[model samples]
Target: MTTTASVQVYTTNYCPYCTRAKQLLTKRGIAFEEIDVSNDDEKRAWLVKTTGQRTVPQIFIQGSPIGGSDELHQLDRSGELAKRLAAA
Candidate 1:
């Protein structure tokens, strides 16, 4: 149950939530792929279409959407994030 799920985060450069999310993931020793959509209209549009969310800090864990910073923090606090991260 230690499968390293690939984490992908869509964020902007100046988003505080994005910063916090990255920090939390780093603290947990998780490596993630960060896509900065600050000026990329196409990617942002794709995110909106794909997630129905037009905000920075959109995250996907092992191809599963895990939402933004608040949700991620909540999951971490509830120990769900750890469980998800450890899932095979």
Candidate 2:
């Protein structure tokens, strides 16, 4: 199911998990806004403060922070991802 929800992915260069996360979203036909924080320390700090995660590939679906790559995959496998996306 293609998602109409706003999806934002915070990523950095040289992160394999970030690549995988983007691939999964593409495979699922989900369009997302990719925010590259490779050289943006300010944005990275903001992400850490917002999501409590210091890693790359932090994902937010419909303004709610879901988590990183592993969490994204788990949501997909459990069929929760579609439901989250479909919510108003």
TM-score of each: 0.92, 0.96
lDDT of 2 by residue, 1-88 (tens): 6877899999988999999999999999999999999999999999999999999899999788999999999999999998888883
Model 2 lDDT at residue 37: 98
Instruction: Report how far off residue 75 is in candidate 2 (Å).
Output: 0.1
Q: How many backbone clashes does candidate 1 have?
A: 0
**What does the lDDT come to for candidate 1?**
0.90
Q: Which pairs in model 2 have colliding backbones?
A: none
Model 1: weakest 10-residue lDDT segment is: 1-10
- The lowest-lDDT stretch of 10 consecutive residues in candidate 2 is 79-88
Tens digits of per-residue lDDT for model 1 on 25-54? 988888889999999999999998988999
